[model samples]
Target: MKKYHFIAALLFCSILLQAQERYFLNSDTRLYTSTSTSAEFLGYFKYGAEVQLLSKNENGWYKVKADNLSEGYVPEKFVGTRLNAADIKTVDNENPVLAGGDQYYGGNHLFVLVAGLKARALPDKTSKIKEILFTGDPVPVNYLPKNQDEWVNIGGNFDYENAKFTLRKFIGKRPDFNTLIKEFDKLNPDAIAERKTVAERIVELAWNSDYSKLAPAYQRYSEVVKQLNDPKLIADTELNVSIAKGLDKHKLPEQIVAFTQKTEFILKGIKTKSLFLTQKELVKTFGKPAKTASIGDECGVYLSDLFYYYPDLEVSVDEKQNKAEIVKVFINENNKMILNANSVLDNTITEKAFIEKYGTYITASIKAPHSYSLQFEDSEFRIEFKDGKLFFIEIFFYC
Candidate 1:
């Protein structure tokens, strides 16, 4: 009896240790290093490779168990915590089946589109997007016949209220739509079998922290931001802070800033296009009037609203002798404000060609005889024209 009790106690302790253990974000982008410097690149973890956390350093470095069964110290900023069993189980149960037609049902499973003409989650409007089906597009369905609207044998276990909430976002409020619900009794066994396969795949990928299988996740994330069509959703300081925190976990604050800036720009462009705001409107909302007047064929007030709503708005204008030549604006704050309303309007109309190429979310620009310059935060791209023909194109980014 004493020996059996001791063994039982040992097993309980092992279980506790396993539960407390944390896994690293198994990804290709995370590079393991022996020393905290660019010169040290010990090895790269294959996509979805998880490591056990051992310890941490004051400089945001972490000691972890690499895949080769070796212990090493890696930059804390590049490591992400692994998903646990509960998270994996939840995703597994919620996985959806892929089928033809906008709406299909299988044994208590039902999916509906609340908005947009076609059901899809791709950047472009096509039915072949391969990402995990979310509320926005690539809706999952089961039970309903391919040709008919009526459904039978929907097999999903999602709560009815939660399912309704998700369904309403895509289909909108409608009394007739609500009446479409019916009891699912004769579930297609084949569909259930397929669903299990999908569920297993989702669980396996999610549990293993395997992101490599999802091609271009970041780019797809960008596309999702665009599809949501709400700048406020992506522009919030909390989102930026959250991203910063994620990067901070890996100890990459600089990368956090760059990613946030680029995402902000993309969101701004989407907002600008959605609103259809003209150049004049942009200036009225954010630009400050010119202080000095210069009268010349090539002389004009160079304005910019890049820093309108930011915490610190930096604007500068430089002219050669008495003629206007250059204008630039820099926004250093995290919040939204009317940064460059007037200058953007003037420039948009005056340099239509440039607006077509650079977009209204312009951060910087320079004008010289036969020369033009443009800059997006942390990114420099130049286009040169000679004898009415484009001559050179250069693009680069700085960390």
Candidate 2:
């Protein structure tokens, strides 16, 4: 009875151990103090040694507790299931499977079309050429295994040499070959799906001129409509096919064209009128006149009478108040052509030339002995006189 009890206890322990998953330490594998190859190598465990899985590290190493009470890390690839004989037979009978689909063999070069041929980096289809021979550019190809199509088998390695040979023919003198290869390597499942979605939308919008109905799929009607109205889309056969045959009957195409034209016109107008006004314009419209001085040179101040409210007086100069005022004036001196009082006839006078020829129109009442200040529309001009002859004129304007 004692021997039977001991045997029963041993059997129970064995069953409990078998219920837990076990890992076997294999050869050519060095155990690390931590779950990283850079960690100190403790030692190598012989093939078929038993280990219990504790946890996994992000670096593809597994931490395992050994039968000797030792703990170490080993590469996950070198660890095998410690299955029983029956389990091994079952696994051997079942063929190991891998996912396979369209495989990107690395070393393939990409050529962008430019001009009339494929160039290194432009978007003209006719100008681009692929390097395929010694006389041609040597291109490299990289495989993107993660971007495999549905039919592709996973876990399959690519023949890098063959891929390179195949892509060399497509490489031209274009220096973008390496960049294209790197991009190909970075291709993943998510990115491919996103690209497909965008391409599909583009095709759909190009075919259907009525983007108003496509609002659910596209957020910005104006932007998507503009893209659909692009000249390139109009020329695309896929876009034409995707669009409804009755698009012309609906007049959506014409509307899109008109809208695009209007938008372009508005943008161009804004650009053209960007530099029309400054703060100086406002100042000129409503600014006070500076002080001035009168020289005894019979100097007469001319103000524009066009915008002026006073129209009764031809020209009046008050020396006592030092104020030169004009009444019944349709044009202000800033807008009048005031030549030398002695040189030209008064009949040749015009409001447009007065401001252009003469300085500011308003002469202020405040004056010095030889100098006087005047206010033009928005500018202030200082007039200096020597013996009643106009000596100097200065005007200041700001941005």
Best by lDDT: 2
TM-score of each: 0.17, 0.17
lDDT tens readout by residue for model 1, 1-399 = 565455335434433543676454432333344546554443334333455566756478777654222345656555666533433211112122332333332222334332122322211222232223322223332211221331211212122111211221232111121121111112243454443333323222221232232222222233334445568634432232232223223423354334334322111232332112334433444455434343232322223212122112222223222211112222122212121332222111223243343332222211122234334345443434444333332333343
Model 1 misplaced stretches (Cα beyond 4 Å): 1-18, 29-33, 82-399
lDDT of 2 by residue, 1-399 (tens): 565455335434433553576566443355578767787764434444455666865478888654322457877766787534432211111111111121312322222111111221111122123322221122232111111110110111121112111211222233232343244345563455443334333323222223333322222222333445666433332222222222222333344233223111011112111112222332243242232333333322333211212221122234333333322112223322132233221323432232233322223211143343444333344544443334343333222
Q: Candidate 1 — what's its lDDT?
A: 0.32
Q: State residue 86's C-alpha deviation in candidate 1, in Å.
A: 19
What TM-score does structure 1 among the candidates reach?
A: 0.17
lDDT of each: 0.32, 0.33
Query: TM-score of the candidate numbered 2?
Result: 0.17
- Model 2, position 237, has a per-residue lDDT of 28
C-alpha lDDT of residue 240 in model 1? 28
